[model samples]
Target: MGILSRASYVIRSKVNAVLNRSEDPTETLDYSYEQLRDELQDVKQGIADLTTQKKRLQIQKRRLEENVEKHNDQARQAVEQDRDDLARQALEKKKQKMSQIEELEGQISQLQRQQDQLVEQKDELQRQIEQFRTKKETMKARHEAAKASARVNEAMTGAGDEMEDVSRAIERAEERTEDMEARAQAMDELRENGALENQLDDRSSLEKELDAVQQDGEVDAELDTLKSEMGKEEEPTANGGDEAAETELEQELEDDTVSDVEVDDSEVEAELDELKDEE
Candidate 1:
């Protein structure tokens, strides 16, 4: 993906992850109350509608009964006026009205039954909504208390341990200080014995001496010539220059070149031997 798209995706993913981890019992309670309220409203509306339907059926039945009475009066008037045909027609109209009234009564009875059922349903739904409200409140309280307890536990277990960390840091600092003091005392003893600095200086002096000796290789060769000449029965050719070089090399080798350092194991042993002889 492009950088912008990837960035957007990561941001959205993190936001969703955080939201998913968070819990909102109050919101859930509110949502449940809203849903129950809606259902309760529907139930009430249904009861009202059924009641209205029952009333309309009653009005229609009343109107049909009034029409039948009016038809009976007309039939009686036609018989009194010596008009049998007119009376029969009025009587027939009255019969038709009676049939219609019967049909309307049946519809009214059915509508009354429906209205009763709606009333019962509305009452039950109201009770359910009330129960739901009580449960939602309980759950909200429990969730709040649980969250408070978790915060308290975190403070006690996590933040409280900082005091212990400070104490441990002080202990470590004291240990380091004691170690440094011991090391300083040891270094002071080494300085009093003139061993610490002299040990480093002597090594450098020895290396310089070895370098000079290697450079005067001809002097060493002449020393071998002198020894060989002195051992032979006859005298060998000797030069003044060679004699001077050998003499200078020997004098330089004999000079005290080592630094004033503590002696080695063999020197200490030789000193102890001399002390024993003196005793």
Candidate 2:
């Protein structure tokens, strides 16, 4: 195809596409039905006009025929009365009336043919219009139903799209929440490890620190009582061990008899005094 031809074809296609997209089948059918009804009305009106004209022509022909009969009677009476010229004039008028009647008859016949054709046409047109109306209504109903179904389908599609988006959004939200929780847990673990290293010398040290911070005077009082009781338990055992050691040493010294040896009175007196001082 030529460039211009291709361009025209493309333009026509676009126009057709626009028209098809914009067209409503139900409205088109209704408009076509209205047009058919209007045509039917025109046909009916034409038939009525033709019938009216035919009737008028028939009336005119009847009057002319009556005049022709009257003229014939006048001619006969004039001929019987021996007035040939009047008879000729009467015959001439009758001929003229006959011609008028003949013309009226022709007009009436033509009008009758036209009226008959118009009636036939009207009937056929009416039948066609009725058939078209039925079909139009059927088509319009179907179109309306289809349009409603399409609207329902569109709504369902929109809902489906929204639901799909919502589902994805929920999934994304859940993922974010999970990531946030994981991050929070990781930070908490790091904080716990760091705090344990710096503050909690041992596992129980954290508990001891917490208890110390939280304790009232009652805990200190209880600790004091426990320390006093431990002191009392150690005091008896320490004093008893020292006393038993002194007694054992005294027995051992008494059991040992001094070696028999000549000694001076002064030395003996000094030794005895020392022993007394030691006791």
| 165-220 per-residue lDDT for model 2 (tens digits) | 88789999999999999999987898878652545355576787777776866787
Superposition TM-score, candidate 2 onto the true structure: 0.57
Give the range of the ten consecutive residues with the poorest summed lDDT in model 2.
194-203
Instruction: Give the clashing pairs for model 1.
Output: none
TM of each candidate vs. truth: 0.50, 0.57
The alpha-carbon RMSD values of the candidates against the true structure, listed in the order shown, are 20.0, 23.0
* Tens-digit lDDT string for candidate 1 (88-133): 9999999998998899889888878887887888888889889989
Q: Candidate 1: which stretches are off by over 4 Å?
A: 1-23, 159-279
- Candidate 2 accuracy as lDDT: 0.84
